[model samples]
Target: MDTDVIICGAGAAGLTLAVDLARRHIRFLLIDKAAGPFAGSRGKGIQPRSQEVFEDLGVIDAIVASGGEYPVQRHYTEDGTTVDEPVVVRSEPTAAEPYRIPLLVPQFLTERRLRERLTELGHIPRYGRELTGFAQDADGVTAEIAGPGGEQTVRARYLIGADGGSSTVRKALGIGFPGRTLGVRAVVADVLAEGVTADAWHRWGDGTAAQVSLCPLYGTEMFQLQGPLPFDVEVDLSAAGLTALVRERTGRDDLAIHAVSWASAFEMNARLADTYRQGRVFLAGDAAHCHPPTGGQGLNTGVQDAYNLGWKLAGVLGGAPDALLDSYEAERRPIAEDVLGLSTRLLEAARNRDHRRGREVGQLDLGYPDSPLSLASPGHDKGVRPGDRAPDAPVTGAGGLPTRLFTLFRGPHWTLLGHGVDRASAPAPRTGLRVHTIGARGDILDPGSHVRDGYGLASGRWVLVRPDGYVAAVLDTAGLPAAEAFLDSVGVRPPL
Candidate 1:
């Protein structure tokens, strides 16, 4: 095969997958038909769970530096103005929940950062190379990619469709994308603004009328504006059209929109693919599911999808069984279904002029407890279980150095954490996995007992953490053999 994976589309989903695959030293081709990076403030809200994913991928610092917390919304009317709290709930950072709030950054900028990280990993996304068609057989997939040079065929072990809602790969695979589309349209764009508060989001109009809102993007001077598109009329997105809408909605003739960076008239849609996999090929991100942009779940969910699939692919390629790949769909598809329902409900609330949101938008609780990959001791279920997100906790290392559980779990390798285990008698390192002992006499010192308390390890046990930061299995005894059995079930056979 020419490559191990062929990823179509270079949006948040595809680029994220590319970055993760690159970290694993996987030979893959990342392609997109777009001439350059996506130029839009399309999906701006990155949830906390995705932030954890970024931390693991070695990009969280850049992500945090590039964005800020979602600002409070300021409502406006002709007579007066009222300041409303943020639609997305925010919380203080704790030992268990470090990233407690969502961060706001433009979608294009997010992709660029991921691309830069991929380049650091020794791979550059192949822009201008488009996947036109393909066919998958019993062994692998044969993809025909069209580029500036010419059309050529490339073979790969797997083909992933991160190609957005109107996915060419999904169509070729003949998988059904079943969902409902909204007829209402909105004129969305980015603009250079004046006379608006940069500290908060400004908006006007009731849900029944023409609604318009302008939010100052975190890292740039641009403000993303959303206005209702006129029904039964050819929508005008020119400067004049925008100026007219601005005046009519905000009632601010002094407010100036100097330039229109990017604009689109979009019709809302909520859908999910019937299946995420078909033999040798798979679908992810918007290709596998599309949700209304109400709760900012679209982009965040896509990133999580990529994170979940990347390690599974790396493990399978390293020697794990192909059956392990099946867990990707099992774990992520249900999350997509839940996210679809959420964003759709949020969309309804928006129509009803109610913008209340809960902790669900954080996506921190998303897990796959029912997935085959999630295993646990039949009698041991006191704290976090298999398929639960492994929480973060502060711990001290050698020489009183400060560290975190998330820090140890950050990388493309499974972490087998032993609590109260003997380092002198601990098992040796195995291929595709790392062994870490957490205790005072162990490799890591749990100074404040955070690891013991935060992880709920009242007694001693072996907790296996997946690369994606989810608990794979928790065992009370049977050290290496039990762990090996769990790994074997997932197609990962470490050299004994």
Candidate 2:
């Protein structure tokens, strides 16, 4: 095979998967037909769960620096007066959930950060290269890629479609994408406004029907302008056309849209592929599922799909079983199904003028409890369980240095945490897994009972966390063998 994997589309999903594969030393190719990075502010809300994923990938600092909290929405009328309303209810940080709220960085900035990270890891995406078609046999996949010069044939062990909703890889495979197109039509654009303040998200109308909103994007001077499009009107994506539309909708001739950067007219859609995989090709991100942009779930969900699949792909490439690869669809397809329902409901709520977003939009509670990789212990089912997000807690490392559970879990390896167990009783460290004991006289100390109480380890217990930061198994000290068995089931192989 020419490469281990061939990833089509260099958006959030493809870039994220490329960064992961580079760090794992996995042979892969990342390609995109676009001439450069995406230049839109379409998906700006990075939820808490996605923030944690970025932290694990060593890019949280850049993401946070480029974004800020979601600002309060300020309603406007024809008079240019405003009334402030909190669109998202913010939450305080706790021991278990450190990132309680979402960040508001533009999608272009997020892609730039991921690209920089990939460059740091000695890899870059091949731009202006499109995957024309591909054919897969029992052995591998043969893909035809088209570039400016000419078309070239390449072979890879697997092909992944991280492309957008109109995915060439998915369509070529004849995978069924079954869903409904919402009646709503809207225009989303990035523009520079002369009169709008950057502190609040400015909006007009009754908060729903026939309204226009301008949200100041973090770390940039551009504001994202969005409003409904009339069915009879011919759509115009030009700067002058968008400016006139904004001026007409807000009824504010004083507010001038001086420049427009990127614009698109999109009809809301809620779609999920019938299957995520067929033979050696797999679909992820918008290819596998496309959600309405109501709950800010589209880009974040794609990032997570890449995170969940990256480790498994690396493990399988390192001589693990094919079952590990099979678990990708088994675990992620259901998530897409559920998320489709969620985003659709949120879209309905928006149409009803219920703009208040709550904790459910963060997507922190999403997990694969029914996954074949999850192993449950019937006796210990109080706090964290198999297929639950492993909570974070403050702990002390050697020489009384402050640390966090997230810090330990940030890497390309499985984490086996032993709570209330001594160092001697901790599970032996394996080649692809790291073992750490937290308690009195253990390798790490949980000074304030934070880990003990937060993790529900009233007595001694072992929690095996996957590379993706979800609990794989929860067992007693004697259940180390079972934990190992669960790892075997997922084909956890030694690192290169």
The TM-score of predicted model 1 comes to: 0.96
* Angstrom error at residue 105, model 1: 0.5
TM-score of each: 0.96, 0.96
- Backbone clashes in model 2: 0
lDDT of 2 by residue, 1-496 (tens): 3998999999999999998888889999999999988999999999999999999888989999998998998887667677887778888989889998988999999999999999999989999999988999987899999998899899999999999999998899889999998988899999988778999988787545668889999999999998888766788777778778777777767788878899898888899999988988888899989998988999999999999889988887776787788888998888888888888898888777667789998888999888888886767858877888999999899678999999999899899888777668765556778888776667788888888877788567888899999988888888877887667666663334
lDDT per residue for candidate 1 within 1-496, as digits (tens), equals 3999999989999989999999889989999888888999989988889999998888888888887988888877668857677767667989988988888898878888898898899988788988888988988899999899999899999999999999999999889998888766787898887788888888788575578888988888899998667666787677677887888776679877778999998888889999999998989999999887888999999999999999888888877788889999999999999999999888888888776567899999999899888775655657778888998989887667888999888888888888887665545556777788887677788877777777777556878888899998877655556767777766555576
lDDT computed for candidate 2? 0.87
* Colliding residue pairs in candidate 2: none
Q: How much is the lDDT of residue 451 in candidate 1?
A: 74
